[model samples]
Target: MADLWTGMVWPVAITVVQILLIVVPLLVAVAYVTYAERKVIGFMQLRQGPMTVGPYGLLQPLADGLKLFVKETVVPSGANRFVFILAPCVTFILALIGWAVIPFGEGMVLADINVGVLYLFAISSLGVYGIIMAGWASNSRYAFLGALRSSAQMVSYEIAIGLIILSVLISAGSLNLSDIVRAQKTVWFFIPHFPMFMIFLASILAETNRHPFDLPEDEATLVTGYNVEYSSMAFALFFLGEYANMILMSGITSVLFLGGWLPPFDIFPFTLIPGPIWFILKICLVLFVFFWARATLPRYRYDQLMRLGWKVFLPASLLWVVLTAGFMVTFDLLPHH
Candidate 1:
């Protein structure tokens, strides 16, 4: 028993602690992200955002979180209890675990796996499952319709997203994210793959079901979509999961495009900032754009959204992948380091 406890329990406990370290701060970041969004959107609309709770409404998210935590979860009479309750849990879990592969700085990741990018991609792709499950389990027409729309949207954008990632992979010549970043030590992929970067950013927006392409959750249409029937902590989980996924995608965009943790320049002032700080600042920038789009862009009509992904982005991304490969092969730009 002692030997087993030392060998098995200790390792498991250590892993759990490491995961908590990553997850706890992420949850806090999600809270602040909501505050930031509200403030940004408010500024854009010429209004003051939440300014009541804790200075400048700093405590709004905390108050909101506490309210949701105390609120009783009410499952619809027609809902599938097991899956309905499980959906948000799964969504939140998947969102948190993606950070395992994310390196904040040198030797800073929880799991420095070789296939980090693939891991992130796979985890992100699975996010739609929770939404689908929630919709189907809710047993409501609105929920089901929303799920169907979300499924189509995610799949359409995913194809383009995959192709865009492939272009980066081709340039980096490695599936590992650290290698991908190191390859960008001199120049970021966004500079070289500008078109692909734009497409990728757009794809992630649709992928996260954010504003503009947020057809599933259109209040006028699907009646708030997959989590329509969810309330209290259940709804809170879905809410946190969405914001968490946004941050995760932002982190990914940072790695694949902006050069994760690498300063803009190697010179004095820029290089003086720590890599992790640089990494976080990049994420904040991307997230600001994420919120900015929500403030400025109107929702896309369903047909237009689908057409943009499949008709325009799909073909364009495919062609870009080909062009990228040809350029790299012709010019020998492959990462030899």
Candidate 2:
């Protein structure tokens, strides 16, 4: 019994520690991402952002988090209490779990699953359920309408996203994320698949419901969208989940297109930095684009959003997959294993 207990307990303990290591930093990053967004946008707009709190607003997220933590959670009178509560949990958990298979550096992953890409895709696809649940449980027509739009938008764009990933898979010849990164040792996939890289970036923006694709949260129509009834931590979960998803998507974009942790050059100064550091820097660059797009672009009309997904990205992605396969076969570039 002692041996059995020891065997089971040790692995579980180590696993829990690993998960905490990943999650704690991630939560902190999510908090600061908000600050960075504000600061970046503020700079872009020629305004000082968050200058008061704790030395150049370094502690602003902490303060905001404390405020939300103490605030009362106001559930709608008619809301289904259990599901309404469950919805944000679903979104937030799904967002965090997607990071399990993400490779920060060579051999530096939690799960290291064979089908990491598929795992990420499935986890991301389930995100809509949370919004739908919140919408229905709130017993509000506006929330429901927002949910409907979100579901439709996510589903439409996901097809294009899937097709784009197919092109990546075909080129890398592996679904394991580390293998995908290693496959790009010579040249990043972005060079060969520039078109798909661009499309993938756009698709992720739509996938995360970011600006220019945030019709579900459109103030003009939905008035704050599905989680409008939520307050405090419940709302914070949704907010945190959004920012977390953006970071996760940025990580994915890094892995798929920008060569994960590989340095721009293998020689001299580039090789001195660690792989994980390189990975983080890439994620930050992609994240900056997310903020930049929000500050610069106007939101798309709902119809335009749908049309871009179906008519533009979908067909283009499909065509690219075919083209990529042809080029691979012609050049004997198809990866073995």
Candidate 3:
């Protein structure tokens, strides 16, 4: 028993270290993503971004965090205090938990479950409940309306997103994200299934409730949306949760379409950079695109948005699924190509 315990100790210690390694960097990245968003949007609009807190505003997120921490929390007089407190916590946890199954490199994952993709879908679906709770708990009309709109929008878009994911899964023949990346070693899925890639990108933006699909928080119409009543650190949690989900979606894009951690080509004898570098680079690029879209595009009308998701993307994704399935069957029928 003593020997067995000794053997297990190192493994447990290593696992803890690994978890820290992923979690710490993820927290830091979430902070910096906000900084990057401001800088990117500022540059796009020809305006100066934050520059005072730190050199070129590098430490601005820290300063902003400190400000939020110092501020007082206020619960609406007629609101359910407990649920108001719990809403942001739930969103933050769900946002962070989705990263557990995402592989950053070869055999580099916190938990590489076989049903990793399904796990992500389920976890993301639960995020809406947090928003709904926040809206209801706040006891405000704007928050309530935002929550209702967000729940409906997320539910509709989620179906299209699931169909798009199904198309990719059909092509890869595995729900494991790492396995999907491996299947794309010869050729990335984006190259062949461009339509699915387009739909996936749109769905992710909708999933994150970013601009054009940002009806829930439309300042002109819905004040500050579900988080309107939240202040101080409580508000910060929801902000962090949104950015974290953005990064998570970007990471998923890397794994599913960009070949998770496989370099452009495994040609060199000794590669200087680690796999995480490529993963980060890809994520940053995707994030930049998100900001770019925000800067360039106008918000879609609610009716048009629903029509595009239901009529356009859903039908397109369904066709792609059938098409991919047929291609797979034909390939299997033919000699190894």
Q: After superposition, how far is residue 194 of candidate 2 from its true place, in Å?
A: 0.4
Q: Compare the candidates by TM-score and give the number of the best one.
A: 2
Model 3 gets an lDDT of 0.88
Ordered from best to worst TM-score, the candidate numbers read: 2, 1, 3
For each candidate in the order shown, give its overall lDDT on alpha carbons: 0.93, 0.95, 0.88
Number of the predicted model whose lDDT against the real structure is largest: 2
Of candidate 1, the 10-residue stretch with the lowest lDDT total is 328-337
Estimate, for each residue in 37-83, the C-alpha lDDT of model 1 and write its tens digit.
99999999999999999999999999999999999999999999999
TM-score of every candidate: 0.97, 0.99, 0.95
Which digits, one per residue and each the tens of the lDDT, describe model 3 over residues 127-221?
A: 99999999999999999998998898898889988888887788788889988888887888788888788888888898889987898999999
Per-residue lDDT of model 2, residues 59-160, tens digit only = 999999999999999988899999999999999999999999999998999999999999988998899999999999989988899999999999999999
Cα error, candidate 3, residue 223 (Å)? 0.5
Per-residue error for 104 in candidate 2, Å, reads: 0.9
